[model samples]
Target: MQDPTATARPRKIIHIDMDAFYASVEQRDDPALRGRPVVVAWRGERSVVCAASYEARRFGVRSAMPAVRAERLCPQAVFVPPDFVRYKAVSRQVREIFLRHTELVEPLSLDEAYLDVTAPRSDLPTATAIAEAIRAQIRGETALTASAGVAPNKFLAKIASDWRKPDGLFVLRPHRVEAFLTPLPVERIPGVGKVMLSKLHAVGIRSVGELRQWPREELERLFGSFGGSLYRRARGIDERPVEPDQPVQSISSEDTFARDLPLHALDEAIARLAGKTWQATRRTERIGRTVVLKLKTAQFRTLTRSLTPDRPPASEEELRAIALALRDRVDLPADTLYRLVGVGVSGFRDREEAMTQPPLFE
Candidate 1:
């Protein structure tokens, strides 16, 4: 049989990411913050850095690092509180730019998005030109710099977008994908975190070239379902499309406290976040079966417990109860303290499908 994948036309995708988004926006609005180490975060013992300017990054500051640690790392860094309203306004402007080219824009966050320019509405001659136009438009409109990656697929495009630091652009042509990925570290591929990296290293697979050396079946035997994905990703194969309105799988809200709280003391926090998440879920037409409780220990380790009831939560009280009950599932010691807590629901199904049959209690 002929190669099935080769029959499909290669997609023209672009990944656009703002540079140090929150920090960069602060720097742009305030002349005093420009060219300085800016750290956007809430200052507290438990708070984590949300964004770090390139200057702060040089001092080893990064997002998700504790604010106290970030301060210690970059003592001179200016800390700024996030202004989501302003960020949303700027994000809207960025989206408008994308819509000018193509409606196939999938926003990953307020600061980054994937765009399918395979069939753009603009007069641009090529995908690279479209990327340049988008980047230039963002700089002009938002007064901030953006990096762009033009590639044949989303995975390569995302990696390419980060190839250059603040205010850079890179392209991954179909003809050059193999050579470009061969010598690069396997960690460069998404989902290869520390544990995965260690596992790959133990097998003497350190680079994309080394990963590609393994037979797909053997890799699957080693890492389960993920191994199959790795086999394909190593060869620069990704079939995911840039969906404009990707289905919302879950809605969640989380809070990081000023101090770590023991498991028993988390009831109030869980209740509060459950309310927030419940309100968010009301906007969707889907009902979720799984209620998840997420906790981050003082040591930065994360643990999640989920329960899928026979029926979806029908009320805020029910959502809160499910979230609270999930705490019972955490096998950690009673003394374990968590610095953060979140409540969410997933395993979504359409309202029609979810309500096709009456509840057991009803």
Candidate 2:
């Protein structure tokens, strides 16, 4: 039988990402901060960088790095606390610009989004033109730079968006997809993190071309379900549609301590984080059934423990209890030091569905 996928019309997807979003906003608001290194983060030993301007990045500063390390990297950098209210306003303005072209806008975060313009509402004759227009409009209105990528699908478009930094656009026609992906590193594929990259390297698959040569069965046997994704991605296949107004997948709050602490010393932190996560969940009508506890070791190893109780926690205290209890499930040695802890809830269901579902044991 012929492949059904090949019969479908080619999609036009665009990924738009703002450059140094939080830091750029800080600089845009304060003329004095425009040329200097700007780091958006709180002034605390335990704080992590929310965003770093390109000036700071030249000195090895980056988002999510420890604030202390960022200070060491760029001592003269200007540190400013994050202002979500202002950032959110800017994001909304940019998102309005996207909606003017296509209703199929999927926001990845406040700083980036995917737009499916297979049948754009605007008169722009091509996806690339649409991308150019959007980027121009964003720059004109927000006084902030944005990068855009246009391709036949979301995966390639996302990768293309990063090909050029701050105020750039790249287009990947369908005919050029294979050639464009061949020499790229395996880690360039989404979901291929450091551990997955190491595993791929172990199998002598260091590039997309190498990954494409492996038999599907062999890859599946070695990496389970993810191997199938690798097999498809190597060939530039991504069928996920741009889902607009996507529901919340999870809610979480995490903290990195000023200093690493033993596992036994995390009770207070877990409780505090869980409370924050609980407050976030209150905004949604859905119920989250799984409680998850995440830990990052001083050595950078990350692990998570989760429990799906028959009923979801009903209060902040209950969520805190579940999160704290999950620590017992960790199998790490007592001497292991952890630098971060997080609490989260996932496996969400509509309120009615959660209330009406039958028990699993029954």
Model 1 misplaced regions, further than 4 Å: 1-5, 357-362
Per-model TM-score on C-alpha atoms: 0.94, 0.92
What does candidate 1 score in Cα RMSD to the true structure?
Answer: 2.6
lDDT of each: 0.90, 0.92
Candidate 1 lDDT, tens digit per residue, 34-101? 99999999898877899999999999999989899999998999999988899889999999999999
User: Which candidate gets the maximum TM-score versus the true structure?
Assistant: 1
Best by lDDT: 2
Model 1: worst 10 consecutive residues (lDDT sum): 1-10
Q: What's model 1's overall lDDT?
A: 0.90
The residue pairs found clashing in candidate 2 are none
Clashes of 2: 0
Model 2 agreement with the true structure over 1-362: per-residue lDDT tens digits: 11213536888999999999999999999999998999999988888899999999999999999899999999999999999999999999999999999999999999999999999999999999999999999999999999999887888899999999878999988878888888999999989998999999998999998898988899999999999988888888888999999988899999989899999999999999999999999999999888999999999899999987778889999999989889998999999999999999987889887766553421
Q: Candidate 1 clashing pairs? A: none
TM-score of model number 1: 0.94
Off by over 4 Å in 2: 1-7, 357-362
